[model samples]
Target: MRGPVRWVLWDVKDTLLKVRRSVGEQYCSEASRLGLELPPSQVEAAFKQAYRRQSKLYPNYGTAQGLGGHRWWVAVVKDTFSQCGVKDGATLEKLSYNLYHNFKNAENWEVFPDSERTLRSCTDMGLKLGVVSNFDNRLEGILRACGLLSHFSFLVTSEGAKVAKPDAAIFHQALQRCGDPASSVAHVGDHYVNDYLTARSLGLLGLLLDREGSTLHLDDVPARHRLSSLDELPALLQKRAEGG
Candidate 1:
């Protein structure tokens, strides 16, 4: 039997926050500022290709091979423009640098409508909150800027922990900060495998935030383990606490 939840671990991207604009739109806007004009659709497609290639080549920001997050992201950004026909090395480097820092700003990200309210509700229930994200060091500034930083007691990033989600080690790092047994912690994220299955496997209550019902077809996920929005969170936690 699982104990009452004492901590709520959150996943950052697409869970509590998301980019204000699509990758292609942001990249094109930045490129325009650099005096380069590119179609947003074209840039978006190229970005998808570049991102997949980069992720495949340098998983987890290439930490294992010493690339680190900064270098890894710079490569992805540079490749994205390169694939869109920009070949000037200096221009690529400049654009990559600008884009990297641009994302750190709060203007580039927007909090989910229900994020703050739900976080506050969790706090009111006497639950501690922390972040367990696959993001890099830039996450702290992003969270702080978005006004959600104060809600969390700690943050554990894959870059900081050297282990990304679906790997379990990252969750363990968050657990250490939580100072609670796995049975008394719950993790919420948008990814099914990384957030739900993995957390459940580790004995934590895994709640999948499927806002779009994208996972509705997955029979393995019970209704209790899935949420359509953050607005549903506090009630769910209360139900769990009451053994409903």
Candidate 2:
């Protein structure tokens, strides 16, 4: 028989907190501050293109290219600003520095309404919590700003693990940190491939937080492993605790 789950691992981004201002919106704001004028629509379009290109080429947030956290982001920032019509090298560097640093602001993100109560419920149930994310260490700061950092006992990042999700190394690293049997842990996140399938394949219970029913039609996702909101988590796990 499987042991009681002792740990609940989480993913950030669309799971706990979401960005209030998108990258394009922030880029336009920064450009205006630096006296680089461009139409908002143009800036937004450019950012989308740049983001898609960089993401496809480097995937895994540029870690696949052997770029460190900041270096990886620097490429994206450069590509974004360049596409937005700022041609001066000096201006690009300045914009990159300010834009990257400004994103760390707590005001730029909003936590899901059910996040706190759900976390507390897990804590009350005696389940240890930690984060397993593809993000860099800046995640700690963001979580702290959102008041969710304290809820986690530990956090493992792609930068720290030397690999990103869907790859198994990062999850294994988190498992080692929790020091529990894989069957006695659950991982929850928004991504179907990165969060659910990856963890489940490793013998960990994986649930997809499908806030929008985006993947509800996929035949591969079991209904029991899907959630529309975090508020559903404690009760679902309670059933598991009861051997349901």
TM-score of each: 0.97, 0.94
Clashes of 1: 0
Candidate that would win on lDDT: 1
Candidate 1 residue-wise lDDT, 136-194, digit = tens: 88999999999999999999998888879899899988998999999999999999999
* Candidate 2 global CA lDDT score: 0.87
Error of 1 at 60 (Å): 0.4
lDDT (CA) for every model shown?
Answer: 0.93, 0.87
- For 167-229, candidate 2 gives per-residue lDDT tens digits of 998999999999988999999999999999999999999999999999988899989999999
lDDT of 1: 0.93
Cα error, candidate 1, residue 201 (Å): 0.5
Compared with the true structure, model 2 gives a TM-score of: 0.94
